[model samples]
Target: MPPALNRTRLAWAGDLPTSRAACGMGFVSTPELGHEAVAFGVNALARLAHRGGLDADGKSGDGAGLLIQVPHRLLGGQYAVAALFEWDPRARAIVEAAVTDGGMRLADWREVPLDHDSLGARARETMPGIWHGLIEDPGVDPDEWERRLYLVRRRAEKQADQEGVRMYLPSLSSRTLVYKGLMAGTRLADFYLDLRDQACESRLAVFHQRYSTNTMPDWRLAQPFRMLAHNGEINTITGNRAWMRAREAELEPELRGAVWPEGSDSASLDNALELLVQRGWEVSEALMSLVPDAWEGRGDLAGPVRDFFRYQSIRFEPWDGPAALAFSDGVVVGAALDRNGLRPLRWQRTRQGLVAAASEAGVVTMEPADVVERGRLGPGQMLLVDTRDGSVLRDAEAKERAASRHDYALLADRVLVPVERHHVDLEPLEDLPAHHALHGWGFEDVKFVVDVMAETSAEPVYSMGDDIPIAALGRTPRRIYGYLRQRFAQVTNPAIDPLREKAVMSLRVLLGARHGTLEPEGGTDRELLRRHHPAVPTEYKLLELESPILGAAELARVLEDAVVLDATYLPDESLRDALHRLCREADEVSGVIALSDRRSGPFRLPIPMALAVGAVHSHLLATGRRMAADVVAIAGDAVDVHDVACLITIGASAVHPYLAFATVGDEAAPRYRKAVEAGLLKVMAKMGISCVSSYRGGEVLEALGLGAEVMEMCFSAVPSRIGGVNLDDIERMA
Candidate 1:
């Protein structure tokens, strides 16, 4: 069996690495098409060769690639070219058939020239046959031609998957082309003869030298994905992918199957960007909406800019992490950074109309006297150059342009209603002892964890590491939280300082159905504004909160128009049955479904909070109702920060730790909530994530002793190594 298949046979060996990467990426752009641009890009990649990994042979690199404007001069203008890796003749035939089936003519097939002798031993063993298939133009505009080509590529991909034929399409676009492989950065042009040809001229080139830290390196995984070359990792990729999957039904018809499951984090980002571009969004505008800055507390920004980011946050969560991206769409080339600015990207402009940007400053050699301007991208900044009009827009100008495209302030004002704050008196619980026994709280929990947090408004610290046995080996049964472990950033990516970077982090959450993106035919600004106004009865009302912690008054406000579902199982009912019942009940509602475990008693046991939240979340996603309702967990078993974080990670939008509040009493309740918020921010920042919206549904935990069935039913997509107790054991323990 292949390694991919064999790894799934045992639970302990099934976990995949977090897929983080530290790499070198850059781009070169000119006012006019020229061979020098391509040469400059290759030269920049060679300078960054030290950033990539080398095989034992020392000749092969982890991965390297170049994305350039379509070489119309070399391929002969008026045709769409597809760069593909098809080793099997049958797969090649299927690809040709897919082209013709889409009502296009297959004009010719050119075998891409390669220097096989230059490849290392390991690279030669895995190299696929490279070919370029030219499809004749069908007398349509360039936009229509690209759209048609996209459909054809999707058809070929689906057909190949159905036939079990291995094939990889690096790119199929009329405006851009990609050439990449498993070779050293210096050898990229040496291996691909087209890069050395004078006719392969372009105005823009995006290049990448990959260093695979978490995932396996392969030829198909090389960068300069369809639209961008990315450095660093997308820490919230798991949650991003999940949300994308949930919102598939709302996507335009042409973007139904846009995201490929086998693609890496960078590739997924490229797919999403490509989809947005195909939907008529400008490249810079789409990127701004996807990776917005920290506008919540940035009073320096214009009101419109803040409103634009606020509106975008409701529809899409930020793709948070440490990222420095170089991207292009043939006509426009640019670079952007994430809010944390964990990666470096520098740019320089020369007097001769040449603009070069790279991970380092000296990649493109130039005379100091000829240098007109030079700068580096700060956190959440962008630099764009438009080849069409020979225009350059820095961070401020680019963002203002994007913000001015629509009346976002008006749209946000009409749709978003802030949750009103009010104080509510609390009474002490009369049966505190019985409640403590029922919820599995020991005296030490209050003395060390709860009391300390109440006094200091922060998490308590311990000097020595934990000495107790893992939950699987312990003599006493533990809560479900104990069987899971949290993952943090390592060498490839740096963990953020939550205290120093608190300004960039956010705990804000929104409640209500998300407004779906406009369809391709209905994307006018007027239509968008009309769709979000208060007069529109079809639009869902949004309730915004500054934090996920809900006090008594806030909880009452949330429950006024919300559906409260019991998260308890009767003596006769199975845990699975109770979960399914709750999911069914949630499916019937449209906004704010609250899952409360407060009803658990001697006659009924509470379903584990993680299991219940994960089940309902997965079910709603499958039923296409996940975005229609927000999930708030009213948990009784949650007393610590870890428990609340676990709940949110498994799809809880917010958590109300009723038991923690009851234990700490009223005066300390506010302080306890504050401590939990601080702890949650620390947990998120440790993984390099910046916001609660991105952290929610991230499923970053690794289950230590969960059974396969339990994982599949309750914790789908979460890695559970070392499978142990079954559902029956969990139920008995509960």
Candidate 2:
């Protein structure tokens, strides 16, 4: 009997190496080189055997995989359809159903020839039941049929997931093929006989060796996904995945119910890229949109280029993290680095028209004289090869072409809502009367939070060995931000040093509704979202309240453009209901909603700023009104640097910490802002994020005591396991 479908293996199921490391290599030639390229790839894999992970049993490897353009010549010419399948009866039925549903007939079927016994007993034991089949659909365009197959595959996979069957397609394309598994590099070539075939040749080949830190390496999780292979971790994956699911309501029918596979962040990223490519986005555009550079504030970029990124930023969040990725569509092949430049990718071009890139230099050996050029990928850089043209495109040339594809400057300038025009003086908070200031800032807050800010102009740090109670174990109730510890980059990918790389960091943020796609019919209101800027010039429309402990003048300014919903004296149920109504009403008003706590004093506390901002932000997102409005946090409770960062991370577009600034005095306001900016930059860099905008609303938070239901609704996708406090519990604490 074939191995049971459920008994799949993963690399991290075994012991992990003390020091994390990973390696990947690829080779592409102009003409088909058959077994020669395969042989070289295999030999290179063998050379990197140390990089392959060990499973629990220690003998079996975690995973290894290779990708190549499909070799049609080996099949003896044109065929109607060709596909691989598991030998299970259920698998067969599912494929048949998919083909019929797609209105394509299976004219014939053929198994890929292989010697089962030739692979050792262990290899056979690890294998899934496998077969290759063919189909025929007369008069159907090949590309269209491929698309139909993609839909069919998704349908089958979804059905299998529902029915408890293991079904996957290593390669299901006429242009490219993928072969990967949970096997060591040394055994991969020996276990899969196809790698030895001289006829299996192609112009481009890329590969990935997994070193997953958080997830166990599973058979289906092996790399060199359909169109790309990713190295390094995506630190922003939680938020990235959440945003993808949130937009599902707007996705096409074929893409509906399509789920990301259960794998590492890299796998999920590949899933996103594949989805976009299938929807007809150019490979370069899709990648650039997902992994954009720090283009917003950089005076170095041409107006068109900056406009291109700014527009795309409105449509998608950066798949921000430490990434070195290689992508292809059989015609164009390329690789990119994360803006942090934490992951290493070195490339070399040969005189013979081959371009090779890997995690490390010298993965593929060649004579120095044969090398035409060699260089390392800089931060947020890309190296692309257009196989059809047989030419390489550097980052500037590639982005320039993408930018020129549309009138991005005109679109951005016309649609972006202007925030720079709203800039305000800091005079409101500075001239506050002593009694009002005293009411806003408590004595304890002044001594600890405010004095610390005055001394360092940054968030205070605890000594390394300082002991604190874990949220799960603490007897006392904890703040939502306190329960959610900040996660940082480690091991397989290093974090960036913000001070050393200040040029690439950005605090620029866009607030408002999406402008819609580049299509001509897109909504004008949607385009209004990208206009808000963090800089002082565009600061007014974003409205900075003097404080949540608002002065009379500040209250007057906010009331002009926004409706202030008082949470100051309301009970839990009434406040929750009022906040809900206010958020919905927020969109119809000007796009700003300021949550204030002016009535609260040392004796009476307001709702926790974290809870208020989170609840409001979550509601806006749930109602599809999040992009239509911006949440401005005005609170006396935000008396420290951490409080401000927490507010922004939880979805505040702009934070007005009236108490902290007031206590520090007017002369120190600019210093306070710089310190807050620097502190937030430090936080982002520690997580391998180069842009504050990428870090904003990213939800890289892990709540310890929050109930699953409350977290699901409010902090969606955050790691809130080991439940503790519910909304009632939080209300009592407040």
Candidate 3:
């Protein structure tokens, strides 16, 4: 099987690195390089282990696909996606950081010298586990890995506790998958990974995600600290550290070990200063005193502050190199990097209402603002995120640097023009799935589809729940259903012969309750049922409980009974829970329909949805594990197919006829594009080459009864496809 289809392999090695070898100390395969890297930015890096490239060119020219999480008011939700490489390396760093290649400890490091050769090899080995961990969620099943983490943290926590210390929570939010990459087994490593555990109280966020012990005032002592994440190499780092250490050559804070192990240089510098934050230097004072952009201020500064920068520069200039960095101690997420703004960094208030910064906008929510959003964040800009006061501060005069800088040699790099963008002109996006409606499958679609199979036909059903959602959507009129409440009425005839008026009337209930047409409570139920009731999801079709188990019930469906999941909430578990709940409610009377936003051959998830995770959903659909197995046993022989629940998910990359066919129409009306593109693909069994031609006219009208099909009547006219058989009917009959 191809790599993407292989479900058993630990995809984590391909994601998060665990061994020092993976982090860069070990072996790695390099790809032939070219312009692709230059076009895409950092995505050109196939395997992004920290490297001191020998005159390496930095560009995402390899054309790694895009990943982002941006605000979308339409669904009242956030849009997030991750492809290869856009991951947080900190998860693995936090681990491999325990020991060094020489078996000798290194000082706290804020920036890795880009020229160091060994930095690449040692760090390379530590990466695979990071990739592996990010792609593979520690399943509900406890295997050795979970046990190992437990042991490690337990031992580490004990070490901390003995000295009044702390450890990462079992939830491991700090073990973050900041970025990831892999498309059908292709390698992916996009950006630096920085993660914070998902806990009300964060360990990394709190006491020590970034703190490390260092020398202070001729004696060692425990001290609070400052943290920094760099996007560009700070060329001045070595000299700066050397000068600072000379200033306090004698002191070794005993608390250095308390915050971090000994010899953490960059960390010590920050920690030593943090030791002074409360005493005199405000945060700006401490940071400016350490990594001041330049001595010149817009105008005024306190004498000490002004005098401090003037003296600091005498030692060395500002840290150089490009960087989009962020750091926090659970209290404040502060960021400062090279004064030149040589590296890309964008920060903005998140939809969660928290301040965040990353090399890319999607890291926060994939906002374009992530990349200098419409010219925000000029050179010398610093962003301070104060969780304590819920305030954000910018340098204000930062943009002036761009105006002052020399321009004009012009004619280089295809005449780089600053692109202009306003609110997305959604009109051009018509016929693209999800203009008004959320475009992918949710939790409800799983059970609703199972319900459809159980109620649709008497033939032994082997329908793949990984089939297209539109197929399930069209089944209602044909004695088909993806859920019990589909029609909101009980089937009067089990055989459902010819599905006449009475049977169709039984469906009146299920079809009526869809979307906002009706409510789920008694008042609406009575009044609506009196005048016109919903077509019971059950009466429309009987569903099979393939596994006697499932999860989508909570994603967006109304469950037949109250349900609670047994699995422990792990990383990203909150999103999963919220989805489950959404399914339970939204898919109450009808079968749920999930859609994929990416090009997953079979899977689709909108936000933070890893590209290859389709298998997770595929496995769940096949096993029906989301629903309790007992539910299947109780139904017994009555239902033709054995299943606890069902799912009907359209592949994220599936041609969306509704959206594709739209030439000009919106939520209110739609007109599909006239031009058609023939997708050349390899078909099954014969497996040579095949062409699937699609268009915008009659075929779609035929599907909606507003158009007609011409190709031997074997095509669907949904705006997206030109000529095709009605796939739902095909799946059922096949």
**Winner by TM-score:** 1
| Cα TM-score per model | 0.94, 0.83, 0.26
In terms of lDDT, model 2 sits at: 0.64
Task: State the weakest 10-residue window (summed lDDT) of model 3.
Answer: 689-698
lDDT of candidates 1 onward, in order:
0.82, 0.64, 0.25
Q: If both were scored by TM-score, which would come out higher, candidate 2 or candidate 3?
A: 2
User: What is the Cα-based lDDT of residue 306 in candidate 1?
Assistant: 87
* lDDT for predicted candidate 1 compared with the true structure: 0.82
Task: Write the residue-wise lDDT of candidate 2 on 633-724 in tens digits.
Answer: 77766766566777777777666676666667666665666667778787777888776555667776777777875686567757776887
> Candidate 3 — number of clashing residue pairs?
197
- Winning candidate number (lDDT): 1
* Alpha carbon deviation, residue 41, candidate 3 (Å): 20
Looking at model 2, report the run of 10 residues with the lowest lDDT sum. 1-10
Least accurate 10 contiguous residues by lDDT in model 1: 1-10
